[model samples]
Structure formats: C-alpha cells, structure tokens
Target: MSIRGYLQILRPVNALVAGIAVLLGVLVAGGEVTPVLFLLVVAVFCITGAGNAVNDYYDREIDAINRPDRPIPSGAVSIRGAAVYSAVLFLFGIACAAFVHPFCFGIACLNSLLLVAYAARLKGVPLAGNIVVSYLAGSIFLFGGAAAGTDGLLLNLPLAGIVFLPMTAREILKDAEDIEGDREGGARTLPMVTGVLTSCRIAAVLAAGAVLLSLLPVVPWWGWWYLGMIALADLVILYAVASAFRCTTSACVRESGATSMLKTGMFAALGVLLFWALIG
Candidate 1:
C-alpha cells in the first residue's frame, strides 16, 4: 500500500479541520493551552481520520461508481488494509483520550462506535443517518469542552447546536447529490425515499433553524464582537437556505452548491468563535 494512499484514505484535510474544531471548542470554554488540551486535539484528529477511513472501506463499492478515484476503488489500498488502519487509529484515539479525562475517554469510545455504525449500517437508513452524523460533528465541541471540565461542556452546548443544525442540512443535501449512486448501492437515503424537492425543503428549514440559533447570546466576553462576526455567517447560511428553497424540482436541486455554501458558512462561524475565544 502506498503511503499517499493511506493518507488519502484518511482524508487528512477533513481530519485537520476536526482537530482545529477541538481546539476551538477548548478555547471557547476559556481553557488554557494545557497538555491535556493538546491530547484532546490529537485524539480528535485520529478518531476523525479513523472515521473517514472506515467510511471509505464500507463505501468502496459505492465509490467505484460515485468516486472511482478513492483509494480502494483506485487500487491504492486494499479493503482489509483500510479496515485494519481504522481500527488502529480508533485505538490510538481512545488511548490519548484516556490521558485527558474520563469524560473525554467516554466520548471517544462512543464516537468511535458511532462512526463505525454510521458507515456500516446507518448510512443507508434515511434521516437516522443524518441525525447520527450531525450529532457526531456537534460532539466534537463537547469532547473538547469535557477536557476543561463539566462547566465547559455546559458552556459549549449552544456552540454544539450551532454546528449540528447546519450539518444536518448539509448531510441531507449530500444525500440528494448522491441519489443515483446511493440508489445503486441499495442505500435508502432521505432524498431517495422522500424525493429531492422534499429533502431540499427539509434542508432549508434546518438551515433556517441554525440561522435563528446563531443569534442567541453567548459568553459575556463575546458580546458584540461575536454578534457582528456571526451576522456575516448567518447571511451566508441564509443564502444557502434560499438556494435550497428555490429548488422547485429534482432537476433544480443544486445540492452541491447549497452544501458548499453551508460549509463555507460553517467555517465562517467557526472563525468567529475562534476570534472571540482568543480575545476573550
């Protein structure tokens, strides 16, 4: 197996983004740069990479059609190798989390199991899959907060909500985008069962909810700076919602475009959180 193939299977960019999210979570909780915080970052990175690798393993057949360039489909990595790699990463992540705190270790174990279940079974189970994925994404903040203690986890709840809603919307949009491949793979996603128009409408509603949630007051120190920065993120999400709502037909469902905007808006929102955390 090529080293690059293993890295590609890990989807390092996405893994890095998850690692950064953990750091943001810690910062938002007013956590100092302790060694435990660093361990959380590493733990999150490995777990996220494991999730991606396992997903690629389970979706190898689908990738053959939807994404032939993926490591498994492109003959860069064997299916067994991918599975073994994921297992190793998951173990490493759990080990690192064990050093941080009991809460974090628990989260790591739960998330690791959820990730495997998501790829192996839930991914084909309509809205169930979307909810699981959303929870997993949102829990990254909770995981980091746990490193700071219980109060930090409580403080990060709103932040988790902010991430969860839009992520759910994006997951639905992605299902819509991959309807054909998903159908061929015998997966019953929301768009497949409910149709693209209905799915897009649901996604629009979820995005709108995220926009509303973004307006809630955060920590005292964030104050107006958070509001101003979050407003820009809200506008971007609003645009995505509008785009979703405009999809009157299956042919009109610009799923990729809408999802891309939502992702950009999420990154912007994360940036706002990071800025406030640093200054506060």
Candidate 2:
C-alpha cells in the first residue's frame, strides 16, 4: 500500500480530533494538566486509531457494498493485516493506560472490550447498539477525567451528559440513514429492526431530551452567556427535529439531514462550551 493509503487506514484525523477532545475535557473540567495526562492523550489516540482500524476491517464487506472507496475492501490493506495492526494498537494503548493508573487502565480495558464488542455484535441489536455507541461516545469525556487522575468537576459532567445525550440521539438518526445497507447486510440497526418512522420518532424524542437536560447547568451556576448559547443550540436542534417530525413523505431524507445537522451543531457548540467552561 502507498503511504497515503496506509495513512488513511490509520484514520489519524479522527484519532487526533478525539484525543484533543479528551484533552479539552480535562482542561475544561479544571483538572491538572500534567505530563501523564499528555501521555494519556497519545495512548487514547492510538486506541482510537486501533478501533477505527478494526471497525474498518470488520466492515470490509459491508463497506464494499456501501463505501466502495474505503481502504480495506478497496484493496489498500489486507483484512487480516488490518486486524493484527488494530490489535497491536489496542494493546499498546491499554498498556500505556495501565502504567498511568490502575483505575484508568481498567477503564481503558473496558473501553477497548466494548469497542470490539460493538463492532462485532452489539452493532446489530437496534436501539441497544445505538445506546452502546452513544454512551461510549460520551464516555470519552469521562475517560479524560480518569486519565487525569480525577473524576472531573461535577458541573462539567452535567454539561458533558447534555452533549452526549444528543450526540447519542444523532447517532441513532444517522443509523436511520443507513437502513438500506444495514438491512441488506442483515445487520439489525434501529431503522431496520423497527420501521424507519419509529426509529426517527425515537431519535427526535432523544434529541428533545438532550435539549431539556442541557439547560440544567444554566440555572444559577452558569452565566447568562452560557444559557443563551445553549438555548441557541437547542433551538437549532429543535427546529431541525421539528422538520423531521413534519416530513411524512420521505422520512429517510429528513432523518439523514437532521442527523448531519446535529453533528454540525455539536462541533460548532464546542466553542460555546469552551467559553462557558473557561470564563463562567
């Protein structure tokens, strides 16, 4: 494989973004930013990369059907080789975490196990799989606290939960977009197990829940700016979800757009979160 192709296999951008998010949590939570936390960042990046690799490998056939240009099924990396590569990365990541703190390492171990399980089987269990992926996405924040040798600020966790809740909902909505490929592949995703309409309604409700929960931190502890930004974000999400609710013709299209918009909103809100976490 060419260097570029192999680089794609590593999914460095995805890993780097995730690792930085981890660091951001520690910083925002007012945890000690030490050398060990730095090391933990690298370790988590490697593990995230490994998980991506394994996911790509496992998804070869399905990806070939859905994403023909992907590295593995596209013939850039051998499937067996990718599996071994992923295993090595995961082991190294866990080993580094183990060295930092046993508590953190235990979390790392479980996280790795969950990733493998999700990629292997849980991904086929409808809402269960979505919950697994969504909760794990949120746990990345918690892992940051663990790596920093603390449980993070309580106030910060509430915000984290708010962020995670919608992200989880969006994940399910994204799954709704993939109903055809998943069903064709015999995978049991939410849209496949239940009808697309049901899955979508559930996604909308979860998204609404996220909006309500996000306001919890804004009451007295947070400043006006915090509440305003969160409200703005929530309003955007609600509008998009409302559109989904209104669409009766092609629920899939609305669901797909809504999920994509949710992701965009999530990324955009990082600045608002940083502002509140740092200044307020």
Candidate 3:
C-alpha cells in the first residue's frame, strides 16, 4: 500500500486531536511536561490511529455505501493491509503505554480492547455505542492524568465530564448522519431505533447538559479567562443544539451540518481549557 493510503486509513487529524487532548489532560491536572508525558501522547496517537484504521476495516462495506472515498472503499488500501497496519499501530501504542505507568498502561489496554469491540459489535447497538464513544473520548484526560499521578487523576475528573456529555451528543448525531449506511449494514443505532427526531432531542439535552457542566470549572479554580472563553464555547454548543432541534430526519441532520458543528464546539471548549491551563 502507498504511504498516503496508510496515512489516510489512520485518520491522522483525528489521532492528532486525541494526542493533544492527552497533553491537555496533563496540563489541566497541573502536571509538568516530561519525557513520560510525551510517551503517553505518542501512545494515545498510535492507539487512536489504530482504532480508526480498524474501524475503517470493519466498516468497509458501510463505507462503500456511505463514504466511498475512504481508503478501503476507494481501493487506496487493501483490507488485509489495513488490518496489519492496525495491529502494528496497536502494538506500538501498547508498548509506549507500558513505559508510562501501570495505570496508564491499563487504561491503554482497556481502551484498545474497547475500540476493537466497538468496531466489531457495539457499534450496531443502540445508545451503547454512543456511550462507549463518549467514555473513550473522556478517558483521554484520565489516561493523561494517570501518567502524572493520583492527584492529577483526581483533578481531571471534572474535565472528563466536561468532555463526555457533548461527545455523547455528537456521537448520536453522527449515528443519525450515517443511518442509511448503518441500516444497510444491518446495524441498529439510536437514531435507527428511536427515529431521528427523538434522537435529535436526546442529543440536544446532552449538549445542554454539557453547557451547564462547562460552567462548573469556574466554581473551582478557573477565573474570568475561562469564563469568557467557555461562554463562547457554550454558545457554539447551543447553536448546535438549536440545529439539532430543527432536524426532523437523517437527511435534515446531515444537511444541517449539526454533527460537524458539535465537533467544532467541542474543539473550542478543549482549546479554551488548554489555554487556561497553560496560563495558570
């Protein structure tokens, strides 16, 4: 396979974001940057890349219908090649995690397994897949904080909640976007089971909850910088919520770009957290 094909299969941008989230976890928990933290970041990058690659492999049939330009569906990478690449990346990630700390290594192992399971099975289950995805996203902070020590882990709990709620909402919207492919692939997602309107309502509630949780950091140690930035982030999420409410069907949700908007808002919130953690 070509280098570009391999890279495309890895979804490097998503993996890089996950790696950065790990770094933010360390920073927000008051952990210093160290060689160990760097290793943990690399570990997360590789693992996330591996997960994406494996997901591509498992979703090849669905992608053929929903995302024909994807590496596997486009014939940029062979199925076997993608599988091998994923295994290699998973190995490298676990090796890197093993050197960080036992707890971090454990998290890495557990996450790796969950990623595989999600691609193979849980992805088809209504609501279960959404929750798993949310947990995996939030656990990046926990994984980073664990690398620093116990206190770092404790300090990151609230940060994890801030991440979890919106991610769950986004996952629901994503399922809505992919409903046609999911239905053809014999998968039943939340939107498939509940209808897009009901699913969108649930997603809106979750986004609203995340906005509320985003306010809690100011109560602890954050100040005006966090308040202003987080308020902007909240507004972005609220806009996504409004978009969700307006979507009555899968096509409407996809056309509204609500899923991508939610992701933008999540990234904005993450950037705000990272900035404040660095300044403080």
209, model 1: CA deviation in Å? Answer: 1.0
- True lDDT of residue 267, candidate 3: 93
Give TM per candidate.
Answer: 0.95, 0.88, 0.97
Which parts of model 3 have CA positions greater than 4 angstroms off?
A: 218-220
The reply for model 1, stretches above 4 Å from the true place, is 248-251, 254-256
lDDT of 3 by residue, 63-88 (tens): 99999999999999999999999999
lDDT of each: 0.87, 0.71, 0.89
Alpha carbon lDDT of residue 230, candidate 1?
A: 88
What is the Cα-based lDDT of residue 131 in candidate 2?
Answer: 78
Pairs that collide in candidate 2 are none
Q: Which pairs clash in model 1?
A: none
Best-to-worst order by lDDT is 3, 1, 2
| Clash count, candidate 2 | 0
Model 1 lDDT, residue 259, Cα: 80
